[model samples]
Target: MSSTISRSLAGRKARRRRSRVHSLAIDGNDCMRQDNIVVEIPTSTARAATMTSSSDPIPSLGQHVDFRQRFEEEINTFATSLVHREPKYVPSHQEDALAMARIDSSCETAIDHWMLAQSFGCVKATDLTEGAIELCQLLVGVDGCEETRKVLETLSAHESVSPKNFLRGLCAGAITRWVYLDTKPQLPSVCQYPQSDVLRSVLAATPNIYRRLVDAMTLEYLERHFATTIPALSKELTKRLHTILTNFRGLKSANTLTDLSDHINNFRVWERYMADAFEGALRLRLNHLRSPMKYNYTFPSSGQPFVEDKMISLYSEASRRRPHQVWLCLSPLIESWNESMDSSSHVIISPARVISS
Candidate 1:
């Protein structure tokens, strides 16, 4: 079976970026889990207090409830163009209802979502660092919005929504329920059984940083550089791998030029030993399958600022020293492939292409 991943550099383009979060370390997939914290909203004692007195000034009497159709007509006429995201739904005749609406169930939530959406600060499709804070606010807002937020918070808490995407893979409805659908994973080339497809989806949604960290933990990066080799893979494992590769193919970063260089350099080395070991192990372990192979890669002595081998080794060394980053063991499945007739046979780990902004 062919396992070559395509790396097309013909259409390269540059984008602008400003960096934050100094020195990012792969904090393992599970570290970012947002579980174990309970956000409680205080009960509405204000309403109870207001109506507590039996000696209320006014006599108890029924108030007129207006007809819906007539009232809606007035409200529509009085509506402003600014209502596109107008804070609340206002009905003119029921000034009382409009007044009540003004008092946000979770005034904080509406404002937070609005600010992020307006400022464009909270629209990250891949990373959830900014979005999670916004999500937490909306999920535990007060008043009528309380119930809805409570429900989502319960689910998020139960699912253990991680600031990291590692736990996200464990959730079944992340793309549909949490993130936008455009970022969902798919079979880049072919379809598979429902159960297998589900597994692929989970892996696809998972954060690669954590995935690599997991591998580093289990495989212990530097213990053995990836030997030039080949391996055979089961059809089931291949499908799961294909899904991961496809997802990573579109991964983009909001890092600066220098940051991107550092990360890319780290990955370049990661590819060497990690890729080699993964390929070597798979080939040696599953030679019984139909085909296995390895690729011949030669990097220029002074291509860019980053040396591929050195960065890979450095990342491994740092990863091993830290204890929380053990998830590297769950690295992607390696599949051997044929790059070209003249080129040596290669083991394909993924189709990851880092996009910089």
Candidate 2:
């Protein structure tokens, strides 16, 4: 309901066109008919008798027979049904938790906080420790005192932290910095590279890198929120996945966000790149097998939209890359998506893309 693209001019125009093409065609004059009622009455088999005991006179207590017998009969009927019924238990396996679309915590913060984080270069680091430390200092300075002995103490003990460890710890440190700097909580800067609006703009244009960042954030977001319904939650996860990664082209290379003529021409190129990454990732997903998600019977007639941006199928791209693990966890999703029998006879992906049968 609160979609950004959903609220766009193009979206509105499409909706208006749809409304015109599919309006109701009700006949103003209506016809009605009434049918005669045919009822059947059953013949009486026996006259029911209320038995009573004189000493304990069950009917004496109320108006009918003993309540005990009636209760027993009811219990017997319930037991009979129970004996004939199949037992059911909730399925043990559940779909992976998915995140809500666009509700990124960093995005939720006020503009000033984002600006402060940006100005501080919180987003600049490939690894977050240095950025975290600087932000810690800035936060302490903001409080007008440098009781940042806590940060100094904390920073001194990190002699052997890896880059991965650094980002997580850096995120934690940013929280600490925000706590020390102000009376309120703050967004961590580890998510940002180059820690500025400019860097963010650049990253947004680079579809591949931007997607990795979003995927990480999406996991973090999902950890904070899990949903049980498989398909509905899956749909939401799909949407979030798409939003987290974007096709980021260097904006300066182009002119504006709405450089329509260029975008129209280069749009397919964007989609193809994303599709290539996805297909590559699916190839990576070949070996490792986790337990199958209890194959959900209620899969939106398999018509559920793949409304998500998936990451590149890179097996830890780096100097010492583990090519074997690259893209291992992606194929099942793509395979499912590929075979989904949506009524449209087509399964569109990313709007700019489609995987049709």
lDDT leader: 2
* For model 1, the run of ten residues with the poorest summed lDDT: 16-25
Model 2: how far residue 73 lies from native, Å:
20
Each model's lDDT comes to 0.27, 0.28
Top candidate, metric TM-score: 2
C-alpha lDDT of residue 27 in model 1:
18
Give each model's clash number.
Answer: 15, 18
Q: Please give each candidate's TM-score.
A: 0.18, 0.19
Model 2 ranges with Cα > 4 A deviation: 1-47, 51-239, 247-252, 256-259, 262-293, 296-329, 333-357
